[model samples]
Target: MMLSARLLLAATALCCFATTFAISMDGFATGHKCRCLTTTSEVIPTRLFRRIEILAPGPHCGNIEILVTLKSNNVVCVSPDEKWIIELIARISRNRQQKKPEVFSADQHVLK
Candidate 1:
């Protein structure tokens, strides 16, 4: 009985944590420019660029990241990394804005 109770508490805590982290995203940005030939410079040998955007309204948020990697002047690779990045960004933003970080335990159920 004690073991089951503990497991239940842990699961609840994990779910809350995941939910908070998941809904925390605010926004993100991405851009690319010409790469310099110098040793200490950033650039792309070919014509490539990247753009990313985050759209959040009230309780709902979404992120779209596009990478244009040019194999040739015309050929490119456009890929989306992961859905977690937006969440991570939002969490960071929230953390920064808040005076202190709040952590909740599953054992202490607080209904939202």
Candidate 2:
């Protein structure tokens, strides 16, 4: 009777371990899928955007993802192929470049 009880406990423990491992593996496999389920081509004004994220294509997803967070606290995915989206990206890039601080040069320093 004691031997049978021991075997039953071992079987239960093994089943629990296998179930937990399978659940974790399933989550890991699905976590890499693309975040965007749909994209909009409608133009959203830059002024309304509070944040913008550009995600490059990876093994998990084959398309570039543009995610915008608006001032209203809403997140939207914009289509990368849209003309307005392209222009928005260019404008943002230019702005970022212009905002970079110029390196200090010794030649420009006034002799004290």
Candidate 3:
């Protein structure tokens, strides 16, 4: 009976520790919402990029990165060497140009 009591106490202590650890770790998770703590060099693959932006390398003199904004509104960097990524960027730009609303001047020139 004494041994059983000790075992039960140990189990209770372990459960309390686990619960405390979990609660303590929960606060740290929110720190990663921006994810700036992670490596910034990752270039992810995206099927569809809603926007592509080219930024000049600053003091670091690094290669140009294609900032791809995915359909879900998340932004990530992509390499330009990937043919598919380049093609997708071109397609997006073309589609954007085609979707431009034509403006008509007061004179009705249909402002090409």
Index of the highest-lDDT prediction: 2
In model 3, where is the ten-residue run with the lowest total lDDT? 31-40
* C-alpha positional error of residue 14 in candidate 2 after TM-score superposition, expressed in Å: 30
Off by over 4 Å in 3: 1-52, 56-62, 69-75, 109-112
Query: Tens-digit lDDT track for model 1 on 50-108?
Result: 33234222322232333333444332322234444445457667988896767898798
- TM-score of model 3 (CA atoms): 0.41
Is 2 or 3 the stronger prediction by lDDT?
2
When summed lDDT is taken over every stretch of 10 residues in candidate 2, the lowest stretch is 22-31
lDDT of 2: 0.88
TM-score of each: 0.22, 0.65, 0.41
Q: What ranking emerges by lDDT with the best candidate at the front?
A: 2, 3, 1
lDDT scores for all predictions?
Answer: 0.45, 0.88, 0.64
Q: lDDT by residue for model 2 over 1-112, one digit each (tens)?
A: 6999999999999999988887534336656777788999998988999999999998667789999999999999999999999987898799999999979787798659
Q: Report the error of model 2 at residue 52, Å.
A: 0.7
Local error of candidate 1 at residue 20 (angstroms): 0.5
